[model samples]
Target: MTKILLHGCCGKMGRVISELSKKYDNLSIVAGIDKFGSDNMGYPVFKSLDECNVEYDVLLDFSRADALENLLTFSLKKQKPIVLCSTGYTEDQLQLIENKSKELPIFRSANMSVGINLISMLLRKVAPVLKDNFDIEIIEEHHNQKVDAPSGTALLLADSIKNSLDTETEYVYGRSGSSKRDKNEIGIHAIRGGSIVGNHDVIFAGDGEVIKFTHNALSREVFAVGALKACQYISKVSENKLYNMEDVIGLDF
Candidate 1:
């Protein structure tokens, strides 16, 4: 069985993950970590990862990046693997995660939905070919309470397109007076309004045609289930590795 330490197990997504865990015979959340005083489903909630006494093979972290450093430290000390589902990390923090991948298996992804990962791979392949003829734009909308703008999945999609092109491409968050998009720019837009779970649409516009690719997340449970799948996969992987949704779904990205 895949014993898991589920961080942020009191949150909405955490509850979804816990419920999904019950459906699988191979996966179980043996412990959880939450805020020091927060109650979390009767599981012993440790304020810090180092305080946890339970034995688990891997960690499924749905907490914020502020808690990442401590969690990663604990994982390294225990030589356990982790699947990071949180977003909004500064560039330096991201660099730290990449550096730490040299020692442990870390599966980090902004969006764990299988469809979104496939969209990323497809954009990478199509961007370079349509670089000159097509204008690319990404628009994402999430719940009003979402703290981050231009969600991590949006950045991932933009980065994939940028990397596929041979030359550098600028990202245009918004266009104001006297500013026109450059030929080599990718526009990313964010919308926050209601309780919409999640929505992403990428539009490729050319002179005569426009092609749109979209994914709608009807429930947060998709992410929860995806994270659990990653937890199971990470529990069996060797150290010194980096993985994403493509690895979990066995697709090329």
Candidate 2:
């Protein structure tokens, strides 16, 4: 069994991942770290990662940006692989993740949904081909408590689209009045509401037709499963490597 230390154990995402851990025979969650003193569905929750005595095979971070530094430091010190499911990292924080990836097996993704990652790959392929006549726009919806806008998935899709295009693509957040989109602009929109798990849409608008691809995640367990799969892959992969869902899923096209 691959032992894991799950951060943010008190949050909704963490809770779902914990429950899903029970369903996988090859995976076992050994310890949990949370800011709140709340126990994780019966596991002893530590107030900080520093207090944990047990050694785990991997660390799964679903915590906030503020907590990331500590987790990264811990992972580096322990020389363990890490799977990051948190979002809203600033440029400096991203640089840190990039730097950390140089020494440890790190899998960082904003959205852990396999479907969404596939959408990212698909967008890269479709964006450039459709760029001539189509205007691309991205829309993402999440739960009310979600703190990020445009979402990690939205940004991932945007970056994939940008990478595929020969020219640099500009990202335009929701527009104001009297504003028009440039041919090179990729519009990203965000919607937050109650109890929505996750939804992302990429639309290509043309003169006579519209092409759309959407991925809707109805349960947090889907992400948990993805994270688990990532952890499994991480165990076998070498250090100083960065990977994503595409790498884990082994999708070449």
Top candidate (lDDT) = 2
lDDT of 2 by residue, 118-138 (tens): 888888888879999999999
How does candidate 2 score on lDDT? 0.88
- The Cα local distance difference test for each model comes to 0.86, 0.88
Model 1, position 203: C-alpha lDDT score:
89
lDDT, candidate 1, at 136 = 91
Off by over 4 Å in 2: none
- The C-alpha local distance difference test score for the whole of candidate 1 amounts to 0.86
lDDT measured at residue 201 in model 1 versus the true structure, 0 to 100: 93
Q: After superposition, how far is residue 180 of candidate 1 from its true place, in Å?
A: 2.8
Using TM-score as the measure, the top candidate is: 2
